[model samples]
Target chain A: MNINWGFIVSSLPLYEKAAWLTLKLALWGISASLIIGLVCSVVLYYRIKVLERLVRAYIELSRNTPLLIQLFFLYYGFTKIGITMSENTCAIIGLAFLGGSYMAEAFRGGLESVSKAQIESGLSIGLSNMQMIRYVILPQAFSVSIPPLGANCIFLLKETSIVGAIAIPDLMQVTQDLIGIYYQTFEALFMLVVAYMILLLPVSVALTWLERKVRYAEFGN
Target chain B: MLNSGISVLVEGINLQRLLAGLFVTARIALISIVIGSVLGIMLGLIRTSKSKVVRFICRFYLEVFRIIPILVWMFIVYFGVTNMFNIHLSGELVALIIFSLWGAAEMSDIVRGAIESLPKHQIESGRALGLSFWGLYRYILIPQAIRRLLPGAINLSTRMVKTTSLVVMIGVIDVVKVGQQIIERSILKTPTASFWIYGLIFILYFIVCYPLAKLSKILETKWES
Candidate 1:
């Protein structure tokens, strides 16, 4: 098959717009997830009574299902109950619903890794519970959680591809549309792969660098 | 509203078709897992090979799969390759191949981690016993790694099962597609049908994946102790 270099060039602007939209969605989705995750992890860490069970169930349900079905349910299923949302709203909510649980797990791991001895030390020094969590627990947990948080960030970014199913016109949707309209399957897919690589590879590299820096800081101190 | 919703699900073998679609989904995941594990073990062993080129190649393969979403990969194979090569391949076959390749990439990482995490002394002792390289791995390395990797492998299987939902986009009659068709057929008569159908699909996926996840967790805690 002959390559269509010109078609690829012509589509660059369209892809650029779609990539921007994808990045925006990912940004909103990830930010929402971080808030949700932080609250849930704090509850779990403190072993808050009634909320813990609800949080656990939410995490399991979110983690087990696919983002596509979640989007479908949010966009299509909820209309019958008189809860309607725009496709963009549904996409962001779907992403956050899935991502929040993974983030909570990562945060939980970090929280658990802060040793009992450290908490005891804080208590013995007359640090109140809130102060203990703020000064003693959070700093160490944040450092430990950085790597997993970065991984979750990347995972959520890739998951934004499925938001196209709800017609948000992200990168994946644009590529599919191009393929359908132009019958330029090879060129369309080529652009899709390149766009993602451009989008993902730098974040992945930066995260690895950040992780290494954190590890060295831990060791150096 | 409720009666119409129930009828939409029960009408004209709809539930049976949904079940059949689910069967196809399970079949694809099961076959991919079995085949992918075999391939992944090999790739994982190669990843730990002493040769730099072999390891680099393995890493590249894993990264490519990791970076691209599976839906794009499905489209490339299901549409691009078939169109380019002018060969006819069914949607199910493409779904199987893509999922297996993805599964292998993921599983390889798990296997590599397990193998690498083993204590170094075991290999040194095996060498001292005059075991051949292959014999060393067969007798000492793989057996121990299996225990370490089982939970991770089980977790990957659950992920693959959940991901098979994407095959619906490629025109495979997976459970999600079945639900969509049912909703489309009954939308005017029973506008509430989508809620029930999609909810059922969600629950269906939950039923399939939740057990494996629980098993992985159980094994992880058990082994940690």
Candidate 2:
């Protein structure tokens, strides 16, 4: 069947709105994940025995469970527990929080790659642990971590599409509703494929470029 | 009301349904990983390929998966082409196809990365030893590559399983979809039933996935050791 470009074009504004929501969710989610992942990773990294085990367990729990299930837990389960938020907000928070646990390990791996010699070197220069992380380990680990961080961010962005399942009216969710209304599953899904491709492809390219820039900075090249 | 809701939810989960879901999920994952690994190996080989055309194709394939969300693949197969082609495909079949397509591209990149990361000395040494093409790959190459390859693949499998959640949107009756059905029914019967249904769904997924995550870490440490 020939495609209806007009019908797809007519959906552009809706797509734009959905795209904006997607980005908003990504921004909030990434921000939460970065903060949570960094703090949790550090705690997991340097905290003493029992605390370290607890952090490890938390990471495992977050990593192992399906994010969709987590969203359902938040959207459907916790509402009864009096921890309700709007579905959109729930999805964003769920994604960010789950994304954090993964990001934390990425941070941990990056930090861990900063060898003992470097840490001792930082200590010799009279920097405290926090200072060493901010000044020494992080800067040096930047190159090592940049690639994984970039990849993880892309993964996190893609994963955010799950919010659509929770009826957050994201790009995918909108497509579902459009399909329901239009009864043209093919056109609706084709538009969705293009929409996601347009939205996500550039974001991935930008992250790669960002990582490359970080690489050059790390090398002072 | 609580007791009956619990019974209904638990009724939805039994050897048949749980096993069916798990079986479908595991089958989709295994098939994707296996076939994808094959395609990826070919692509990965192409990365080191001397032919310009081969290298370009490999690069393009890697970029496709690297950028596009897995959902797009699902949509393209399940939503876009299936009806147009008049193919009688189940959602599970569509999911498998999409996952394999996605997996092949991912596995290729991992393979290429691992191969590239190997010590240049090892290859040169193999050549120096007058080893044949198979000799070098079988002996010097594959072993060294295994350690690096295992952890990434483990993580990817975890990813694949978690991603099966997307199948729910397409009517796969996955854990999340089941949870959704429970919630809807609960709303009609008892509003509070939604909470326990979702909570149980979460625990089910956790039971399935958490171990893989832990195993990945364990493998990472073992690799380091």
The DockQ figures for the candidates are 0.82, 0.65
For model 2, the interface Cα RMSD in angstroms equals 2.1
Model 2 spans with C-alpha error above 4 angstroms: A48-51, A127-134, A184-186, A216-221, B1-16, B182-192
TM-score for candidate 2, residues paired by index = 0.89
lDDT of 1 by residue, A64-121 (tens): 9999999999999998878999998898999899999999999999898888888898
lDDT of 2 by residue, B17-80 (tens): 5446656666766787787778877777668767888878878877777667787677667766
RMSD of each: 1.7, 2.9
Q: Chain B of candidate 2 versus the native chain B: what TM-score?
A: 0.86
Docking class of 1: high
Query: Candidate 2 on A113-156: residue-level lDDT in tens?
Result: 77788778789889987898788877877777777777777778
* lDDT per residue (tens digit) for residues B120-176 in model 1: 999999999999999998899988898899999999999899889889888888898
Candidate 2 whole-model C-alpha lDDT, 0 to 1 = 0.77
Worst 10 residues of 1 chain B by lDDT: B1-10
The best candidate by TM-score is 1
Chain B TM-score, candidates in order:
0.95, 0.86
